[model samples]
Target: MDSEDLAESVLIHLDVETLIPGTLKHEKCEISTTRKCYSYIKKRTFATFVASKRVSSSPTDTSPVWQCCDETFSDPSSVHKHVSNLHAEEIEQLTTAALDQMLSQSEEAFQKQEDPNESQSDDPASWIPSTSHLSEEELSKGPGEVLLYYSYCQIRDPKLICSWQSELCSRLHLTGKVRVATEGINGTVGGTKTATKLYIKAMLSHPIFKIMQVEDFKTSEGGAECFSELKVGVYKEIVPMGVDPDTISYRLAGTHLEPEQFHKEVQSLLEDASSKNDTILLDCRNFYESKIGQFKNCLAPDIRKFSYFPDYVEKNLDLFRDKKVLMYCTGGIRCERGSAYLRSKNVCKEVYQLKGGIHKYLEQFPEGFYRGKLFVFDDRYAISFNKDIISDCSYCGAPWDQYQLCSTDFCCQLVLSCSSCRQKGLTACCPVCQAKEQRSSSSPSPGRPHREECECTDSRPRIPNDTL
Candidate 1:
């Protein structure tokens, strides 16, 4: 059968829902098979059409004017039905043009597919946009770039949010991790600039994230293949502060201090002798994160993880009983819950947090009070804001801030190692891990070495052996 006849037969076998232009319910539609067919055909046709028009000299001549209407249907049958019923004239025109071109290029197209040496064009229009799933502006942003962003808000159903986010991220070719919880969503995704921007727009458009703005997103530039894969999951809490979301309410948390206000507060506390004694600048990040970079005189807890924050707070509760506690974290989500936890315990006279946290603080005041490198969770690992090097090399006593993973097969701990020490093959975080690596390397088996116990538990790379 001909292309038009085949399209009609497919449409006849499939069910299409007719609805008002703006009243389609995306959640109710299940168009798995039809969507696959639509995507495949759309890509093939658009690619061939763009290739055929690549020789046009005029800018307008090269641009293909698509006549598809604004209203989208995920199912191919639904799209065909919509075109046949509402846009009969346009469908007939497209069908005729597309079929004619397909027939003329049949030989060349088959040859191109078979020839391994033939490279595909890098033009934007060569690949069809998933317009049914994204906006025109989003599609115009193109691909092959990356961005980073996060959000915190109330989420009623974390699992449901996870499912939706997973689907959206997958469709957009995004990677990175997302944590959904009752309190909100905490995510760090890396994708094409277009995909990431659309993800943020779609998120802000959702009812749950209506309060969020574009400025709330913290972005970073990277290649399109920054992250290895995407991971969207549901958790008890986004930041894992070990506090009940119901008990410690973020709405009643500490007062938010902007970058300038926070800087002034820090300066005033340092200059004012009397108030300096009463005020406490607390670092609400993990020991590893704060060890390299922190505000001078800030009381950063020497804990392993955020889960240990509660115990540290309980032990130091007496110290904050009459003091004004000022807390800050990497992004501010942790501080929201951390400050709330402290206030709920009635341990401080007043509570305050740095709005947007260290990330924003550095953006505003690159040469501010904060010193040393700021630890991050991405592949870049750490970033330096100032010349201060607070951390020392794990193997050697020389000052260093660069972090490297333990050289062992299984241990994933991070350690500060100077260039000199790294050159000396002292890569393991601890002696135990070093021994493990040595044993694995000396083993006879060529495949992945057998698992061995190493004392390296967390990201911190303190020496496990007493002598070391």
Candidate 2:
């Protein structure tokens, strides 16, 4: 067998089972690097593992490595902030710019695709590797089924979300990430609203979900379809901050102003503020989530992880606290706790948070609450409110709905890619993932796919895949 073939065989046989949950690694962080010189920057406590990938490129125009959003970062270390921050725009910009300069030959779209009318040496064949083409059987299985999540939050369980990918959220046909643990449940599930409703129902009835009021997901009248897969899992904490224990804290509903009161206060605060005093509208959702939508005037932190919200807020504390501080998130839960946490530390002096968070406000002012899309945590991916679709297409730069993402690399992270771009097989997740899959094991490549940032949970402690 060739050297590369030998590696593939070794990888499949080299105890991939070792990466499975409860088998060797308690958490399913299975890794399979597509290339060599894999490096990562992880938090001391393992709360986060920021990694960068280095592709073996040469002066030759001939390389199998389809350099999809892979550039600038000489190694994984420099790419640390890129992944942790979900800097899709920055990555896209840099990669596109670099690819433009090297037009001597386009990257191989995929090795196997063939065009009937075009010459093999002239045009590259491409495939949108995402599961957008859901099979009828898979859709019927649980197209719109909801997967519930909850958390018994505390410092000890501060890192619950990543560790708890053990929650038995319904897999169905959805393909987004989910996590639940002692601290709470958090994730991005995509599918039909009905499937989401079932999941929400289960959570509302769950012992802990009973304490939290998760909104039942709704379908858009004239928007893109929902998630293509129903992925669900559990983690250690609802949100992993990757910070020293001393900096972590969480507070919920009862401790803060009610949704209505908070909303009224914000409206009044805005009216009373001096026009030039600098009223700051802050969006506290993850980067992927925020890319879809935000209040017209809010500072979009566009963070990838929730725990980093505080840090973003602290950085901008001086810019807003002195004036009017209007904060919000997917639901009121985050704002309630986020505002409380900031107030506890005296981070902001004049603060007003969205009552009931954005969800509640959308109930009455769906068309007028602000502008742009609203990030959601269920199968709906996200909803475009008030005729606003601000998120950019990752590939074509068009305004895209929430359901699309590159099927390339860990491009598993949600992103906007136009239909044309997707059809061009430009997904970043799938091509890279497939390349990683085809890579020969002998290269001493990272032992797994780009999983340093995520451990794809194959099954959950409460619900076994075999049972499904």
Candidate 3:
């Protein structure tokens, strides 16, 4: 069948049933499957589409993204130079650019410079109308704290919107990315309170924010500063999962454990429960997030993207269903939707997840049932929730990313590895993971050759693309 016909056939034969008395997990499976197919096709055609329009570009290539494990390089120096010169070049470029922009922007407040009014309009973005907002005593009434969170919404009015972000950001100084769209806004912005308060006010008053329950709309469980930046903008939807006409479901359908309680329960399971079990522990986190830590017997799906998760779970439901299935994600966000979806399909016998995710678990355990750092999409690299170091890399097997990847550039596999491996080379999480060389802004540099094509397998189900 043609791609379109295949897509339809794929969507059929998928039965989504909520195990609860009566409920339906939004046929998110169909929506996600369709998107995955389109993405596959898009990646195949995007280059052609671009090449058709431009003659100056070459077939894209990239530096091999590597994941190191027990791997100790005989050529450490060579690998270091290769990493520093080859893979790290563009990372340096972006950092340098960001630094330059910050530096140049800091050279403001000219005295008797060119034109006086130039200050007014030329730097409208810089202008701040001063006002006596709060007293030093009140602002200093309490010690400052950190706030990490995911916040998204659509932009209704920019005159009110852009300034809203700028004003609060200027005052509180949180850093993140945001998008504005007619459809709606979606982004995870994080920062300090003084700054968060700026955007918080607008959201607190919006209708969309109101629609979500106290848990989702206002998930303030993890202690301050789990997130480092706060950015606000407009986007079509907060999360970029594509839209399809699949009837999807989103409702409570799990043994939701509070953060502290979940922490205790996870520990209890690890100590008392069998690591070798008929039940399956499923980490609903993206590949990168799982690289850091997961339950003892959990099933880590080799997926880098969150949008692809439902599809992965659908494909693997057979392996886990009939068994006691415990699933979880960072902030319980995915489980909130994922568990409900799974039950809709009768995929697992028992479904449960931590209430606030590892973020909350960390607060209670101080150390945790899992180990290592938790990779976040934000700039903090990862938050170290567990004191124990339980994971290592899949490649040479030294350490894991606490974040992992696949081999395809389009699938620039996110995976886990140790610090030494992360320093030595570039590779995605599993061998099944895609190598990202060809399509990334950075091409695979030939500074170093592979000892052999990576033969590692992620503990997860899929095999990584082997072309890196």
lDDT by residue for model 2 (1-468), tens: 443453344333333333322232245432212000011101211111121123455535343222224445544444654543454333323333322322212234323333322221111112112234556454344434333233433322323323222232333334455654544555555445544554455445433335445543323332113445444444444545443323444431222345566556556645665643555566667766766666654566645566766666565555544454667876654664566556544434345566556766676677654567776654456555577787677556788765654354443555466778767755443344436534534243455565433233222122111100
Clashes of 1: 0
Local distance difference test values of all predictions, in order: 0.66, 0.45, 0.47
Candidate 1 off by > 4 Å: 1-152, 442-468
Query: Which candidate do you rate higher for TM-score, 2 or 3?
Result: 3
* lDDT over C-alpha atoms for residue 392 of model 1: 92
Model 1 alpha-carbon miss at residue 111, Å: 64
Q: What is the lDDT of residue 197 in candidate 3?
A: 49
Prediction-by-prediction clash tally: 0, 59, 84
TM-score of 2: 0.48
Ranking by TM-score: 1, 3, 2
Write candidate 3's Cα lDDT for 1-468 as tens digits: 343442233222211112111121242322112222222222223222222222222434232222222233333354443433333333223333333343344345223234322222323233332325865443323333334334322334534444555564545444555554433443455544443444455454444343333333322323225445545654443444332213332332456667766665555666765633655667877665675667665677777566676676566666764666666777665675567567666545556777666666666665556666665565355666456665666667664445544443344444555566656654564434334333445555456553322334335445232110
Please state the error at residue 136 of candidate 1 in Å. Answer: 14
Model 2, 383: alpha-carbon shift in Å?
A: 2.4
